[model samples]
Target: MNLQVLQQLGMSERDITLYLALFQLGPSSIRDIASHTGINRGTTYEALKQMAARGLISYAPKGKRRFFRAEEPDKLLELAEEKRASLEQTIDSLKTEIIPGLHHLKPEFSSGNVRFYEGDDGIEFVLKDILATVGKLEEKTYSVFSTKSIRHHLYRPFPNYTAQRIKQKINVRVIALGEGGEDAEYSERKWLKTDGQVDASYIAIYPPKVAMISMASENYPVATVIESPDIARAQQVVFEALWRFL
Candidate 1:
């Protein structure tokens, strides 16, 4: 079957082949297993040693020969569960030790400092930051969107993200070109038409900063975020005027 899945489940390719070979041939020596799997003799020996260590295989010494055989496949589940438990314990210890230390290692920058976020993860981070920060500052947010970059991203669950944003009771005002109406599924509190002025523009104006995002090709989504009080106030006035009329 799929070797990657077996690898992810903690089996090396050689171990996987050796286990399957053992299952097929009952009990066999290293040379027979190597011939069956096409793995070199040294590699087959190593795989057998590892499998034996993990309790997936056992060897019985008869006279001068050692025969290797597979243990019950049900032991794989037990081994996997043991690993999970060990991982959980390690995670708990790290959380207790590391998370408290994070407070001491504070960032060198101040809050409301302009941060440029690019691409899908960057976009998601900015949106989540807005929801957390602006949700307390402004009751509403206005959005001007283009469909170019967003149409191709497979990053997050889109509808779920929109639903969560709306659930926060943060109002959204939208100014869009013709195609924008069809793409943005989040219902706008206010909708304005752009009259086809710009090419592939995405803009969001928050209290502290104004961000413009555009994707030239499918790959890089560039965002320019500015944190100037003068510029933000000017943009706010412009948005209010557009909101009042449209």
Candidate 2:
């Protein structure tokens, strides 16, 4: 049987070996158990002590010597249940005490900041963050400079992002830098010159934030989120001017 599962349940390898050895050898002495499991005597003795403390093993004194034997296999299941209960209690304590303490430790800043995210998962995080932060009001809208290359990277992983936005009734205005993304409900799209003039970068303006996503590199997808209201407003102004011209 695979004893790695026991290790995952928090029993050490030496403890597992010693326990199994005891189970097979039926109340053997420490030296015999160590020899049977190919573990050193000192380490075997220490593991037996710890396992006995956990009720996985027991010892009996016979004259001047001691013999160790494994408890019934049912005890292993009981130990596992106890561990699970202890872990649930620890999680509750962390949620109530540690997490709130850490949240209060975060410093507040006045000026806006920039955060960078990389890889496909990181890009998904950015998209989810946007969805969570933006309000659900009908008048709320965001603008984007969408490009085919970035969309190719994004849509494969997050196929339902636009659908989710539409479901949430969030409106978007998009300026396409190249060809081929359809305009869905609750969105407006305008195209720019598509004759290989634009690179594979996307910019989004959502009031207090401007996100620049780049998919041009061979390494990984990258995104930079700037949380400056002044910069976002400037980008929105430029986008509106170009929108009118187009």
Candidate 3:
């Protein structure tokens, strides 16, 4: 049976078995249900107690013993709907109140920060950082050192990066290590000749941060972001010196 719905409803595996057992053996005592479900009696009772709290099952007195039965299956749907509404409220609170309050608790000054990410998703975050960090600057510009080897993989995670950059009016200056880099609006490109194939790598110097992306063993994409104004400025200086030379 596809029990994904039950799992999504936050039902544990033991609870699922006990719940179905209750369905098959209606109005049964705890001992009968435990024997039928093969779960220990104590665990079975605990599961039933929690399930009852969620309105999944209920019990009443029958002669000398209590008999348990599964509530209407539709109760599961109601529980799910309630969870959805709660989640929406939580998200709103996070956006409106929680996040800003937490930010205030963070340190005012950081000498350095470094983060590492792996695979396509990681590279996408690095690209997003480039846009978010640079877009806020007075210059709204950054520089890139890209190699032809990594050209294909660089934008694979973010094919629309250039379009988004253009929309944001963010400008880039690219120094292509080998041939084969495209030009886009609000961008300047200059190439440097190389004798042999260079390793797949990309570097972006956005003020207050520098992002590096490259292919590791087995062609896995990896990225590192360093948030240091001093380091960023030094790298920017090197890039500008090379830009003027080329």
Best by lDDT: 3
lDDT of 1 by residue, 152-215 (tens): 4422423355666668766666655444344343446444445555555667777666777776
**TM-score versus the correct structure, for each prediction:** 0.60, 0.66, 0.67
List the global CA lDDT of all models. 0.70, 0.83, 0.90
Worst 10 contiguous positions by lDDT, candidate 2: 103-112
Among all candidates shown, the one with the greatest TM-score: 3
**Can you tell me which runs of candidate 1 are displaced by over 4 Å?**
1-4, 87-104, 108-186, 191-200, 205-211, 215-221, 225-246
**Count of clashing residue pairs in every prediction:** 0, 0, 0
Model 2 clashes, total count: 0
Lowest lDDT 10-mer window, candidate 1? Answer: 148-157
Candidate 2: lDDT of 44? 85
* TM-score of candidate 3 versus the correct structure, residues matched by position: 0.67
Error of 1 at 230 (Å): 14
